[model samples]
Target: MQKCIFRFIRPQDWFAAINLKDAYVHVSILPHHRPFLWFAFEGRSYQYKVLPFRLSLLPRVFTKVTEAALVPTREQGIGEPPSAALGGGRPSPGFALSRPSLKVLCRPDTKLCFLKSTVNASVLLFLDEGYVKMYLKGRPITMYMPRDLVDTYCLEAKADLPPKKLKLDWVYGYRGRDCRSNLYLLPTGETVYFIASVVVLYNVDEQLQRHYTGHTDDIKCLTVHPDKITIATGQVAGTSSDGKQLAPHVRVWDSVSLNTLHILGTGFFDRALVCLSFSKSVRTNSNVCFCEKKKNRFLFSCVFMPFLSLPSQCSNESVFAADFHPTDANIIVTCGKSHLYFWSLEKGSLVKKQGLFEKQEKPKFVLCVTFSENGDAITGDSSGNILVWGKGSNRISLAIQGAHEASVFALCMLRNGTLVSGGKDRKLISWDENYQKIQAVPELYGPIRTVAEGRGETVLIGTTKNYVLQGSLDGEFIPITQGHTDELWGLTVHPLKHQFLTCGHDKHVCLWDSASHRPIWTKTLEDAAQSAGFHPSGATVAIGTQTGRWLVLDTESKDLVTVHTDGNEQLSVMRFSPDGNFLAIGSHDNYIYIYAVAENGKKYSRVGKCSGHSSFITHLDWSVDSQYLVSNSGDYEILYWIPSVCKQVVSVETTRDIEWATFTCILGFHIFGLWPDGSDGTDINAVCSSNAKKLLITGDDFGKVHLFSFPCSQSRAPCHIYGGHSSHVTNVNFLNDDSQLISTGGKDMSVMQWRVV
Candidate 1:
């Protein structure tokens, strides 16, 4: 066999290679283990099987070579060459090669998850290692893990929590202890709590500490001793020790133990007790003085001079006014209808008596009496005469005549020696030391209810018409302020501050600073404020409203704290206790409510209620000590309630109107002709009363002025009426001395000044 050799050749001519299927092919092999090919394909490997050569068409003879040629060799080796010759063997003319093989690898296992296409679906459950990972649009958002899975993925999320609850607290409460169904509480909480109910607890000690149930009806007046250990009470109308059914009697008791101490009556006389005064004297035989009177008759005086049951003397029927000597503390003085009496303090007997005004021409009756600062006395009569008496025997020092047109109601002494008087004629009159008229002012609209003197030469006047007037001592009438759109019910000046507070039907409290003549502030209440007062320090103000609501406000901040009463009746008046620890509110519900103001000033608690009044309560006043509360009711009675004992000490009926006659007249002609109409007449005047030295002043609606002095220990009347105004007298104010007065009225529509003398 001949060895085959491969060779490569370029195409010599394109036409010569076209049809030559079996033409010579050229192949080249690299230098190592060689094969010849027609093309130069680089870095490629292939495997092929050699086929046996065939000589069908070629005419040749060849030797078979078992080894492939490393390079073409023409000579044969000595012993192994050309040994065997196949019949007609020739090298294969051409060889075929295999094409290059290629293999490819791919990964198709990863996936992305998506929500199903349906409306209104929510996430339910999820599993870890699941094929699907949640995504919005081929972007991964969140992943869920099943409870049993332990996946390592961080979660970036937020959550919202639920809300909390509110809390509240309860304070103290109280129950009634008497038959009157009075309620009281002392709250210690900052916020006020609604009172759910009140129940009275039973006490085995049934004997009341203070008992005043003596009247056939309800007892009217009560007075407790200064020590708060003793109590005295009076009945309206009853039999005396001598079997006189029309006479009123009095009883004294040991308040703490409820023991009867003394019983006194108007012996054989059908008289009623109007007033009482106890002796604070430590000396033997010091008396307890009181006033008594018969119906439509004159007032008389009685003295239980000795605490023992010794014979006590009563003044004659002529006495009209009586009072215990304020300074003496032992001596008692009295005035008859037309006479006066001075009684011995220790003996329970009368010392001296005198008759001043004549009976025939003595106007109608003695109306009032009062004592001067120097122990001198003044008496007023219905004839408008004022009689002044010195300290000596029964001798008259001065006489003021024609002071008022009607009976005198009030009298007061000024800083100077002059006196002021107010009467039913609705006029105010001023008088000098000699009892001579100095100045007169007519009060228009309504009667003057009260007068107050202020510092720095100012005087304040309160009128029934619901207005307050201020003026200088030099007779300059300045209208200060007005309230209650309806009537001037009550007025009280701030005890320390130059400001004054007024309340009325307007349901508002107004404060006026006198120095600037400007209204400082005004507070409107939910109901009509009948009365208002400032705390002794003036830092807090207390107002009583008609809805039985009491409000205490911080004057500076105007923040209010309200104390609500059980009933919705009108609270007529209110007063702060002397020590400022308690507040007393009187209401038409016939109950006096006491509230204990907490020390921290955050809350108020009801202590107790004093309920003895049978009718609507109209007014109330507290003693310097808060232990005693005095109240006046529409029943024409005054009662003293002692808080410590939770009882009434003394009940006294001062006067009772003829209800039948007054009612019939009001019903019959109240709406009739102009002359008898209830409207105050054109000629009507204004009047005011004062406890200052027993002075009364009247200013007519027409501007007439009058002055009178009603002695606390003598009988006297209004002197005369002084005419001055062209129209009605609206208001009247008294200066230091009754010698100077101020008046305001209509027509002129301006305040007017007058000199009494």
Candidate 2:
């Protein structure tokens, strides 16, 4: 059916009449605008006018409708509240309108900061200026800057931020007022960070004051007293002082108090005190002095009676060598250039003197003199001959001639009465009791400076050419195995087996098998190797390398098992304990390292380190029982160590310029010690045994061998000198039957066999 609907619409400020005929009419209105409607009537016309809200609309506006009836617009206002007529329109029954409100809409961009590709930033330090900027994957994060970086960042970060940006995810500030100079960054926890700074200041003057300002020279020799309260210094000429220097002075002072104790200087010509030594028995209160005479060019040793006023007497113009008897505190022996003399401290007179072989073309200058294992006198001379005089009247018992072609630099007597000698002419000789040369090996490319024998036939020879030779007693001189690339200063043979060790300028410890003539192993020491030897058992080898690194190596494996000590200025010698448990390493740094070796399944480990020597360790040896270890260094003192107590047992000063020293069992109760005497000039070497036997041996720089003997057993006695070699004698060895002796040296490079004829 056809429908008619009446609707009231508010347009601006007036009401409207609308009719719906066949279809419903849709109408819409807005604030302050006219109303709009659409109807489906065939023909219809409506008029609307703007009026005030109080005005009412007239009806019958749809009279022209054709197919539908019409309804007046005023009828639709019936449901309106009274307020509808006011300016505020309330509500209609069909729809309600609320107050108008404001709402805002926004869209934000998500761009992040970027980092510069060319400039990479590192966290040097954290400081107070600004946060440290770090870019991760083109995102920036800030870290607290270190104090040192604050000043630097202030100057560097002044430019505008780079086009590439960084994303900042975190930041932290510096704390405290003090600024650090150096910075280190570390992780605080799992994800946090921390910074550490270190400050430094330089002081140049203090370092210079400590090393340069000294009394005189390079301070070659220094000796400290038993209490360590006093220090004695020996100054050589041409050092810190003038070259024409003579009679070098000895100064004593309190080490801690720095107070001067005493000064000893000579009035007789400006003669340098070449060597000095203190007594091992602290109660003795006396020191020995060895001086070189300039006129006749001789060596003399004086007891230096400090408490007594009587002037010391010169034994003889021929006196060239002397030393205190190791066991006796008052007795001393001197070997003259032509004769040997014995002196008694208690008697204050020359006990007995013996004249050497007078048959030589000229008075044979006694090159070296020493005591044998039985307290008998032994001597070598310029004629390349070795003489031994014991209890047998005034006649010489043993003589070895033609020991070496050049002057004999060193001589060592083994426990089995075998004499080992080296000389200037690059020759090594082994001798027998009758002074017969048993084996003459000429493997050294330079002058043989030293020779040592191990337990068996192994012999160790050191040369001036920075190399060492290990050979057998069968006249087979093994070629040098190149390990130390510098001049070899010293060498020592193992007390037990065919193994021997050496040290040189290269600062390396090298182990060699004399039988194989090959280097079994080598170790690089911080300092140069001066001397080394194997322990009594041949298991551990002690090495005295430069820089004071006294080390012990396992002979079988050549492993650096232990560093006995360090911080030495120079190390000179090393020796092992007879029992093969302890090692002694000596350094030019004026200290010795005594260490114990622990074995674990063929590996040796250093378990202890000891220090005792006060200068470079020049010589070293161990007792047969291994209870005592002896060492000599630049301080011109011999030190004895007792490993059981881990302390120094005894220290003796052998006042002679000890080039080398060793211990050997000769007689039933006698152990002999041998060393070089006289400076680099004459080949006056000496040998002595604990039994007090003395001998005189002379040699020239060209390798000569001489032999002589003394009668006294308890005192340092003199012996008769005998001439043999045309040149210096380097080595001496006793025969198997003890009747003949063998000698070798430089001039002819041949080992000579001698007898007691």
Candidate 3:
């Protein structure tokens, strides 16, 4: 140690050093031997699944593993096994490690440093095991090799593929509040939907999802072609983050190939495309009908017909749905706003006739329309009635009264003449040719928005609360996708397990399992939630509301233990001290409320308030010893405080070197390089550091999550960026083990989970 220290005493000498990420975790304890590492912590029994850092045997185990991995390289004259410290005879300016293995190769002109190994079969085996244990729970450290280095060092390179890089594992949430028919049931057993701009096709039985990311703005409506594989989806008009105009448009694509077949209406549609449908009669050249928000204008075009808008008398009435006659290609039926119109194609112009109610009472609206096997028009109305119209009369011939308890929203005719109807009553009902109710499914999670037939007696339903459910006539329904109904903000990770908690503007607090990518439990509060944190013991969680009310709930029982209000404004962030003795609540009123925790986090008492910021408090972190705090505010202020005295540290140098228990303040000196090349102060919304202190992640206003090296000091620091959210990313959190990350979207109402690959 003395010799190594003396070698670096000369100020003129330059040196480089590297620290292995998650070093001790690479060493695993055998299943039977794992029990030997067991201990009691806060009345809970725990055992190490991997070699703990403080274990006495960790050094020898790590060294043996490193040596075994570098044995193959040693034969090629690599200098030596990695040493605890290195001292060079001469001054060295810089060094590079072509290979990550711990074999040290020093020449007169170059010196390679030690780092985590990504080569050799033994190291690969350890990584594979770690992947299983830490999968979807921690951020993974990924490394890449240049092509030339792979060919020179790894002879069997093609046969030995490197470990997969960390990537997005899953995206949560559904977009349904403002759109219609967003969910479609494909014949390939894939339920199709869109969140933000990306189209997602999910298979329920296999628990898999594939995405089609072709649109730039939020998708508004979607329809499946008659052939069942082709799909046409439309989007809203808006400007992207880079000032690019994302015009309203329709994209027709092949679902199996996921390739865009045709992009239509790039500059033609106005505001948004509200409805889309494909003609069934035109087999060779499929015709499409597009409804835009401009005075309910309807455009029709196909291979044989010119793109033209049909003339309408009630231009102010909103058209909810339009369909080509099942047997007549020249006839179109449109229904909306107390009016149903029939139009006939004639000499490049269209003639329309309004369907009259005659002696019957006129319904407020006709929500959806389908056709029977006999080509009779079947329409569902706002009064929960099904009206069968004659093809020739353009009038209602029969009315099935009170088919649903509330307004009917969707209708589908099965191949066997069975009609399925869904509505605001949250019921899915089947009717025979006689319009008699055959079966009624149990009430679902939300009001039904759309319905489509599946195999046999099964049906697929899209609900207002942003869920897709598949069920049989006998009422066994399973949710294929579920998401929040409003904007999401709060995110927190479990202390020990692969679980997390999220709360959002929808007034729902959800606990999710990273392994399954689904919610484990959900508790609803009276107000929307903005911030959340798990106690150190993992027994209780603290949730802060938009109205500044905060509550503590039992993690296991999900029962509210206690509740309190800090201020009238929102609680932006909440964090517990590393030692679990105190909780800090950051509020929009520019105050940090400190509370002393007792009885394992169920009880709390006011400690005091830290008040030094001029703007709203955005984020805060506790010092390692829980005696000091660092906080960021909306106005880009970074201040340190001694929470014990509720006083600010007047001297910045006194707290400059303090090691924080966690790193989350966006304006911290260590995270200065996380900002983009040209960014406003508010571009980044949230920041989190891995528990290992090796990685830092940021969620930004542009719907991006960036991963950077911890304490990124370089200007324009290089990082990995991922995007799935449609709106601003509100919060990001790394799990306790640093194996996974969770991000929430503000307007998209979505949660996404990422795995370190």
Candidate 4:
């Protein structure tokens, strides 16, 4: 059938088709072949009558016989060659007929479009390529698929191939909100965590990161195998880029090689895979116990083979976390809203028993669970209490009340047997074997979501605000990984250093070390930041806010030196003159506010405002001499301006002779080729030229970054395109040396550092 589709049909071709109803009954099998279909059932012998269902040779045989009969119609030019029994149900053959009367052959309610067996001709009927790919793949093309096939089939693709010559050095975000078991300290000194559709393996000691670009949507849960080398991560269901529904599933891979070993539950799980765990015992085969969002949707499956399931009578609680017993693979514990279940496998059947609170009141939710060295189940509840349940009794044997100031979110047992608990109160506390408080570290930045032990006494904490902190038992916890919580667009590179600053709608302005992919300092602002720029001396940086308020800060001390406002709107672009004499602040109010720089950018005075643009200013680049500027606006207007005179230059010939300091203008003559065909002139959001002026990189609305030769003057310009950001690539910038590139995601709230190879 596929061969027939390829031989006769093209995606662009259309026609009317006829489906021969009960077409298989039209052909009669020979007596000798009919005996082959004989069957005996319930002590009764049944002889073959018609073609049987699910016969492997039926489609081929029926298609051959039906095509022979339809050849006469094709010879008479009445129709094209017919395709018989495409669906194979009852030999409902289809023919593409050119006759106008045959157009109504397919009813409106029919799933398949009817086509006449005639010459390939145009018609009003349409078929989407996404559906064609879905039909070819023989399944729904949802959120999670291989990266290469995503763009062609997915409805919402969040993962794509990294750019050639551009390696994704790090992802500056952590998925911690309402997720658990997501942070792990692997044996190789790599910290495993996930953000968006990518799993990041960051090594704190080396300041390096490796990415596992597997999942296609938002990751919800992660777990490590007993070997500490194998890892499994799960993602929530999402639509593909073309709107195909993707199922929630888990992926197991080697942490060192970063090779996927297995993908579990593509079509089996629903809603989301909340949590998963690896059984400690692997003598026979590794087993994984996982739970999902729906009621009683739990499965105990082997990593390589068949699966066991819990009875349907199980509780309908939303499972939050699951763990296998340290010594017994059959013993599993799952915790969720107001319920703690102790599940065990016996005689190839699964059974569960509820853990009793005894004299203690039941907590609202059991947020996390872990196994102790002595085969005890330690569970943390929403009431800021920790309960220890005996393996035999399934009842709370020890209770530690007020272990934290707020609801306990995570509990971890270190190698030295020192138990640590983190909670919504922004505190990390340590307890001794007797459950007595040892020490408490308070004043954390955000609510702790998950906790894992690092080297020695240090513990890694995953926070709800997308932060991963590393701290010792007696020291302060410093954030090792941080990301914006809202849309981000502001991005600027240091003039002379391998450093950059980013700001976003989350109100955070962060100075980052581009080489290490780590934040050096972060300051929260009252209003969301929209644009940023650094002075040529790299001593002071200006951060523009959404409300037309801009602040210039001393780069060294991060001290605010000045604050000024133009109209009440967002500042879309901020650029400083290469000579360090002027600063341009382009606002959404359709004005560019120019300021004179003095005292090495410590002081600024209003020079003049460039106002001829009819729409909000989107981008601008100053000439090297600082006399002329080119700007783009939201209304697709590209205009040249003279900042000193605050006048728009209308002569194209005059502007063509000017040498610009930057080539970021999207609509300029030298770079007109940047716009693809059918584009409305706003597809490219940001453009940056390399320091050497040899390369131009662009960030577009579809989360793609393309690097083209400088002065791309040809339409449909050839370029090296890359994808990593799951949202719009709001901004792109290169380091002063042009050895590194940075791109910011708008809605994914991530900063991706790319190394130029």
Candidate 5:
């Protein structure tokens, strides 16, 4: 089965983007293919009720469904019902067919009209060769971003390129809709966007994992060191200090640690240039600012950062670009405001300085710089010229003039000895050894601010705005970006489909299709969601928040069905039982509250509360039979509770209700309130048990996962100790087969999936 790229459908195609929502999932999975998609983990076996990932001919199957879906809308003015789950399960919400059935496939610039709106089929779809050879600036081209990105950054594309239609001649039977969709109608044929290609490359994958996210502020500049083991990032400046604004900070981070190894910037430079003072009378120091009847003083401390230039009253340009030495990662060159400063990375002190222009020449703001493979420095100046400087030299050895018509904003040295320079003129020119332009491309969206070498002949070009594209020497470009901007707090894989939901402190809950590794949709909440769990039947999702509020959301509509507010504290753990009758909420208030799921989980009522733990609850899980509740507390104690009677199960079988609410101390509490102490003081942050109800696993603060046999006491030793996580494990989950475990790192941003025997 062959598949057509959905994004390639021209604007004039049969329906708008709104119709194609979850187009493929609408195709019913054939009875025979369901068995091949079965997955088992931690002793739980699951079969895909809908189409799963990695299925052979998946695109073709989805395309067939799309073709069938569009036919009814085009011929009869209505869409056919989804055939995938007609008899039982819920069809994808994205595949909602309408009468005079208009289907919006993806999120375009605006909401597409459904039944109320109809597009004329008399208008034909335009064809683009899909790419342009090269282009110049002053001309704007619009690129059709991904189906759901809602991006329409009009970039100037295709300088000196002609308009050509994609002509296909088929003498035999033709099934594809490239030319036949609008046979009699002549398309408007406006150039939507221009693309380029090199090395006979195909289309962009769009789902590659390449984003490096951590910084909260914008990245003013960055440099990959010569060793390729370290990267230095200069951030956009933060808040002002002492009534005076400071430059952005520079952070050096090792590839191994992924953390800032050192910080350097404006703290050292403005020592004596400016002393901002308020009207005050002080006795301790004149530099201090304070006011009082007798004497008042406010003190300020000044610490110097190494190698930063002493800012004079006249010059205060921020350093936006830097480059590491060709042979040594320790040596770096920084250029800003016409001055080139060389510095030692180890000592953080200036080694030398060279002026970009002559003594009488006006100062030119140097915006970008790079190092050639041969140890020569190449800098792009504001004058649209490329200046080449030799080692230990103050004068320019070679200058490439008339390289660009405007300010040269970026420079990159490709591995093939070709020098690439981009400027505000929208021209990306590649120069040979003699500095003559071999090829020029002006099909960029904005002014190129910086360029870094990527895989092979490709280079990562960043615009002045928040966009970066992977461009090849031959001019093909692919955008590599992010899906999430913060650390993930919880992850839940759907039991029925190839989808999962991830929540983060960023207050965003993102749903992703595991097969494509692409985000489906992201919904932002008012408060941070600490935990997310899908119902046993995968129809609804339960979310617990830091504000002690729990929500039951319809999985399809993502609409809140009900909400229950508990004791005002963080509800870190929310779990739905296998039978979907009870919801367990673990809170920081040292209490595990139970809610009886009713009306098919539309609303929940508090049934009972199991309190008595000395410390806050860290993690909780329901027993396989849904009779017992097991929870781990911060004080390294695991407790068992009988939810039916709202009581703790101890050896003594206490019949009386123990009101420990008034007893604040642990020693004064009743013996039945506490279970056997677990973990020997090793803080357990995450815990889970096997489906067989035999083995219990706990991930502790010591970076170890311990497995213990059930029905044991404090004197029992763990049956096994597995170590893998480098930091404290924040979450632990058992797979369906009960043979493997999934653990998430606290700070590493990695989810480890491995087997533990």
Candidate 6:
């Protein structure tokens, strides 16, 4: 059941890989859809500023509203989607057009027939008749029937002459009859697949048998081993980082058990990995071999970024496509910004790497690549050209200019040796082996993102909008559809392993190994928890509650290590000092409480309360040396406190230590979260493991999260509003590598995990 969910997705439906930007916040509910979403909270009957997450039909509602908004834009010249190219199976005309892949089937001999016997001969002489014909095995066997059969046949069979039948894409199935003992493996998109555990019964709805998940990003590339028992998947990183680019991850899993065998992270700061393929020969360990005795994993990474530039401001060449050599298990070719790198999987080394652009020519990025059966390297570039290179050769063997009006996004070789390419210009072009452009299919659903060869000389086209098109040289086609079920709120990625934790008002904290995307365990809490953070050691989790109580729980046991009440009101903030020596609790009591952590965090004792805040403590962070504290309050005032003094830092009689340090938090989820400037935001809730990079993160009512590089003065601070939240951002924390930022949202009842790169 855990693994079967992945089968819902058709493997090449790339458009389904969506990272919704403030999803619920962007969906405006109509008056008709508003009634069910209405609710009263916090003594107010406030309707949602955006669509709430609790609605059962959010997906349908969202899709309907979205289509409504895009209708007018349709006239702007995008053509009708080809009805024939849709997958599933072509729906019968005028049947309200359901997806073709889900029809039901019934026994053939159950046809409707009607006939009556006139035994009375001369007594009225009125008779009606209908004939029935049935097929046995592929031959037709006719049977005469009475016209009265309408009353004798099942209503379901009479109303519909034929039973519904569902056809699936990517089934690439073998012809067989003893299917009861057979197994089926299917991809669910991204980092997951389904393993059919029970014998499959045709046309019958079967519960998901098993599922496996591990990839953290979209599974843009997939390869099945020759044995068909092991599957490899490549993940697509969302984007290169603001200040630096990072490489994406790849993994190999056993199709039988759905267990991950290896996670491949070959290089760092490279472009997002978009394509993958497997070699024909089974790999064996050799002396210079990069793989282990069991399997081979190779990584290809790109380089450093523009120094001092924000990750958003910085950019680099990235790998948009790659594929393995047709026969060699060791050779792989990758293309990016005007360059190609030939890598040896056995040694994890680049055998040949170089830029492909001519010195006097304008540079162009290669968007997709493929290998011919003859072992030639072929690529499609942004400049609208198809470039071919000989096997093991770096020189361009042939170049066909202006292959498409816009950049090409997909390329694949069919069994007949014809090369097909899809481009952003909405054109699909076919080229002969000698490089002559012969035909074109224009005005497709959208620009293709990827393509795969299908049985019977057909092709699967994954589009930019997440739809798939069944492409054939003779041109006959069907449409396939795929989205998240709930709002996400709290997200924390594991430090040492490829695991992460997520929790929300769903009342369950789900732990997952991102490499598998399968939940290891889920714990339902007794009450709604407010904010959460992890200790520096990654061994414990500290969560605060609305009732002014907080608990430090062991990550391994989920058992309370310590639960304490700080004030009469909510304890919105809980943070552990960088050294793990102190735990800070900021509350509604107009003071920040400090506790000394001892016995390796098993115990805590009250140190002293940092007082003098005229109002509730809004936010706090420790000094780099851990000797003093900086805090902000509800009155738009910031104070410097020497914890050793248990009071405000007073430097001299003329002027107290009224020095400015840095702004706390980003804008709040509430509009009022911003200060007088409307630009600089404020929040009563903020956190700081306060690392040496002088960086701290804050979230607020503005539904925004900001990262601050400190040593900042009040006049100006170097910061970035990093990511989005649907509602009030309750807390923000960094993972071990600080490559990803996690946050929890309040009211929205969701948690979203954002990777820095």
Most accurate candidate by TM-score: 3
Off by over 4 Å in 5: 1-340, 343-351, 354-369, 372-412, 415-484, 493-500, 511-522, 553-564, 606-614, 636-682, 692-697, 702-726, 755-757
lDDT of 1 by residue, 426-465 (tens): 5667666454543333553245433444434544444444
Worst window of 10 by summed lDDT in candidate 2:
101-110
CA lDDT, candidate 6, residue 574: 57
RMSD in angstroms, all models? 46.6, 40.9, 17.2, 16.3, 31.3, 32.9
Each model's TM-score, in the order given?
0.28, 0.29, 0.75, 0.73, 0.43, 0.34
| Lowest lDDT 10-residue stretch of candidate 3 | 128-137
Backbone clashes (count) for model 2: 147
Off by over 4 Å in 6: 1-210, 215-223, 234-249, 266-277, 283-316, 343-349, 353-363, 433-444, 482-757
Write model 5 residue lDDT over 1-757, tens digit each, in one string. Answer: 0122343445555533223222122233334423233322233333333332234323323221111223213332222222212122233334422322112222122121222111110000111211111001111111112222123211121112111111111000111111100000001211010000000011234322212233323232333333443444434333221123444445555544455555654453222111111112222211111011111111121111244332222124544344446565445566666566554433433344555456334337776667776778887777788888786555688887767888887786776878888777766788875655533433433556455565556666554422345667566665442223334457665656756676656576766554454456667788787788778887888887888887877778788788888888988778776678888788899988888886667768788888988888766655556666656566645566777556776632231222111111111111111112221233445555454545555655544555655322111233455543434656665555554545554533234444444
Worst 10 residues of 5 by lDDT: 191-200
Better of 2 and 6 by TM-score: 6
lDDT on C-alpha atoms for all candidate structures: 0.42, 0.39, 0.72, 0.72, 0.46, 0.45
lDDT of 2 at 615: 50
Candidate 3's TM-score: 0.75
lDDT of 3 at 227: 86
On the 0 to 100 scale, the lDDT of residue 426 in model 6 is 64
**Model 5 residue 81 lDDT?**
24
lDDT at 468, model 6 = 44
